[model samples]
Target: MQEIKLTDVRYRPKYHIAAKSGWLNDPNGLVYFKGYYHVFFQHYPYDAVWGPMHWGHVRSKDLIHWETLPIALAPDQEDGCFSGSAIEYDGKLFLIYTAHYNLKEDGSKSYQEQNLAVSEDGINFTKYQGNPVIKPPLANNTENFRDPKIWSDGQDFYCIIGGQTLDNRGQVLLYKSHDIYHWTFEKVLATSKVSTVQGTMWECPDYFEINGQKVLVVSPQGIEPDGEFYQNHHENGYFVGQEKEGNFIYPQNSFRELDRGHDFYAAQTLLAPDGRRILIAWLDMWEQKYHEQADGWAGMLSFPREITIEDGAVRMRPIRELGKIRRETLLNESTAQGQYTFSSPCVEVQFKAMQDLAFEFTRGFEKLSISYQNGKFLLEKTGYKQRKITWKMETLDVQILSDASSIEIFIENGPVISERFYGEGDLELKFQSTKDVAVKTYRLEL
Candidate 1:
């Protein structure tokens, strides 16, 4: 690949967390430690395409502005360092990740084992001397084990690792640890056998609690398409349920997709000091062409979102800290319905529609449309898959965050659609509605 400067990247995001260069995927090792919010990701720095994995590091005092750090973990003894989580234990930040190795040339067989790394100041890290802290569980044929999400209940530390049975059924394994090193297998928390839509392999598993309710999130593979759902090669979703004596108990039909978008996967969360559950996820999908690869970078992360449970369903909203990036208000609660222009591509548009409404964002000939009619929300752009959601409410509240190359659409009390687009020059926004719609627009600066 020819060397290219990231500053010239046309589709690079302004506020989202993307690698300075090269390839980036799954957000890993998310934790709040030492007064900084740390985010680690699976990266390959040499090129835009995926290669041997390394842990790329970034830190922020707040979730909006981030500072890139050095590479945390590389493929030293293992073929690659896969996804995992982080925790602050004993005044040190601990990273529990999977060391992946390929046993066969055809990629038919592989080995995965959990390892540990420690950081004293939450910047530089050192791998544990006695690595491979946890191996595959011996209870069943679980060779496809990886992505450990760890947490503490104020007592023993608990972990949930994604795995698949020998029969190719996706499952999550539970484990417990007291000292953060040694761990013992507890049980199989849940499996694909409970529901037909559950995929064959689970890649990432996250377990947390909100408002006295337990939620299990995972990235599952091999799920077939169902109408407008499961169109992506993989899916990220969660199950709301209860835990009983180390086992997760949820209804078979309780699983719901976390984000209804064309490019969303591998979501992880961190508990903020202010008692908020904030989440971030990869803004790219598998088997999709990434336009930014030509500019020496590939993937980015979604903006930090606060997760909450309302009406027995998970609701996600952009964090309040995002307000710090607002530069100037272009339109404040305006009811006009005509062409609005912005000098830069980074902007935010909020609106409330009581009737059918349509909004189009254009840059030259390229256009992206967001419309709501007859209780349906639709997002469409050229050369991209269409995302639609069924909404039952009479009034619709919408939030649109646009960066240089990405757009995140948040529907109040509904689903969110995040996607990537390639456009240049200034932005032209046109709004159309039968009745007056209250709109607010702001210019966002990084």
Candidate 2:
């Protein structure tokens, strides 16, 4: 296969972090250190498909523009370096991740364990000599344990790893460590019964707190569609509750999707310096046809979003630093309703409407239609089922960030939808409404 230049690859994102020439997934080891925000991802550099994973590194002073760094971790005795988290301790950065090893060709026999790596300068990393620090617990399935999320509560460090029981029930295993090395099993933080909506295997678990409520976010596999929710091959959602006596307590029916989109999974969050929980997820889903694979690259990361608990629900808004890339205003109107065309594929659209409204975005042979009527929001795209959500509010406010091949639609007080589309050349946006709607569009220059 011929190597494609990064500048010439079709559908390559301008503002999003994507693999230069291979496969990428699962935002891993997100941390702020030494005046820069570091992002590490699961990457396979040899092909545009899943393989032995390595940690790909990039850093930015502001989250808008990123500079690629050297590959951080590669497979050594282990088969791959899987997803995990990072923490700044004792003036150095420490990464705790899962190491995967396959014992058979068919992968029916495999094992996963937690490992540690330390970096003095936040760029070059050295794996701990005494690796495989924490093995799979006694009652959990070894092959299904991975994606460790580690954090501290000012004293003892806590780590939560995604796992499944031997009986095929999804769960999260908790561990406690005073130092960064030796760890002890704490307890099963949470678990879900084997069902269509809650699958058997849980991956990439993240635990955090907001407004006195603890949130457990996980990606469950083998989810069968439940109406408009759990409609993807895999599902990423969260449960809000309280942690007491090492157990997470929440309503049994409290599971809600983090993003209602066709292509979103393995979300991870970073606690910013100013006390903001920011998140970024893999912008593509499992088993979906990746059109960019033909160009020798496969996946990208969603734009960083600020997470806040509002009205008993988690809300995600694009990071404010993203405004640094705004260049020219394409359209700005107090009361507008009509069709508009723009040559730039990368742009931002914002609007508010009181009455029923419809929007259509078209480019070349691809089109995406969105409508809000009678308190129900509907999204229709080519080659996929329509996604519908109910909005309890009277007014609708939407913000859309469209790049070369990806679109992230954020509805105020509602769920977000992130989708990928393929096309080339000029883009057109049409707005239809019975009454006046305030609209604005800006060209996002990366």
Candidate 3:
């Protein structure tokens, strides 16, 4: 089919890489096997929006550069392989996915099953004969048992799958296994309700430990559109708290939104081969109602972020390695314009509007900034041309400055904008009489 990619865009952002075409949802399987980072996602290959589902795959040695691979898993004579995770064992890569085959009489075409597939080369995957390793324990009505994320504790393996009860409450089903093929149902660990914020099913629930604490990340669908809260088609973020065995600390902190900006969901995390908890999220939504679908493409991948718990909550900072995307360096000089350039040349420049000012930047400037407005900080961009999208300073405070790749705007306090741009032309600074400001630009090389 046609591929919906950013091939036409002159510059792709640092960590976000999307498929050429069609719809993309949750990040399927993220794992480090054979020293290469492999990622899979829920994809509809035929169009820019949702169609028949398949697991789209890609890999990277470093998070910045990536190479696309063939589709990993697909629907068979029975059903389609849905969202799940992957792991490595005894030199073999194992993928666990939700297999859906209609079991209802006349088989009304509704069935949700958990299946397994194994791969040694990390490219080809073969389903086990002992498949459908674990069936839904709650009888014929529970059509929601799916998206299993399995892990280990040095001994036996454990898995958490997203599901809903007959009452339609969102929940995570717990299962345990010694061998990867057979999984036994454990008790329900943490159960969320459908009214637990107006969602039908919770998809792609991921649990892992960061440093010393535990993190439970989930994607809840059907949230009523609330400006910054339920911004996505289906929202995927996390709950930071303590989990003792199967239970979690109640009233989980205010369910923090993953990335504050548009284009992020169904995020899956994998402990990198380097011991860092790296993440990748589906750049599209589940609702099939995005404005960008008309552009001949649907979904993308959010910028890969290094997630860490700071101040009792999940605070993400783009990996430092993303700096490698810096194309070429310019304007690494100091200038005192008006009366407030500064006493010293710092890497980060902050400008405030004391009086209306007109600032001028040199032509060699690769990236320029005019942050610190009124009482807040902003990640802004303005070149000599007519292309600019600045983050409102009131919503965002901290951001990164990369040469030509793009600028990341942190809105609603954190994790918002990843507007990609190709700033290869000349750069200039103009502070209108109404907006006085001092500007700083950090140019890069390589």
Best by TM-score: 2
Q: Model 3 over residues 98-215: C-alpha lDDT tens digits?
A: 9877556664858778888899899999988887888877652377788999888868889998887677767777899998877888777666643447466778899988877878
Candidate 3's clash total is 12
- Which candidate, 2 or 3, would have the higher lDDT against the true structure? 2
lDDT to native, each model: 0.88, 0.88, 0.64
Off by over 4 Å in 2: 1-7, 105-108, 334-336
Candidate 1 accuracy as TM-score: 0.96
Off by over 4 Å in 3: 1-15, 102-109, 139-141, 193-198, 225-228, 288-296, 330-397, 400-408, 411-415, 418-446
- Candidate 1: segments with Cα more than 4 A from true spot: 1-7, 104-108, 194-196
lDDT of 2 at 251: 83
Winner of 1 and 3 under TM-score:
1
lDDT of 1: 0.88
Candidate 2 lDDT score relative to the true structure? 0.88
Structural similarity to truth (TM-score) of each candidate: 0.96, 0.97, 0.76
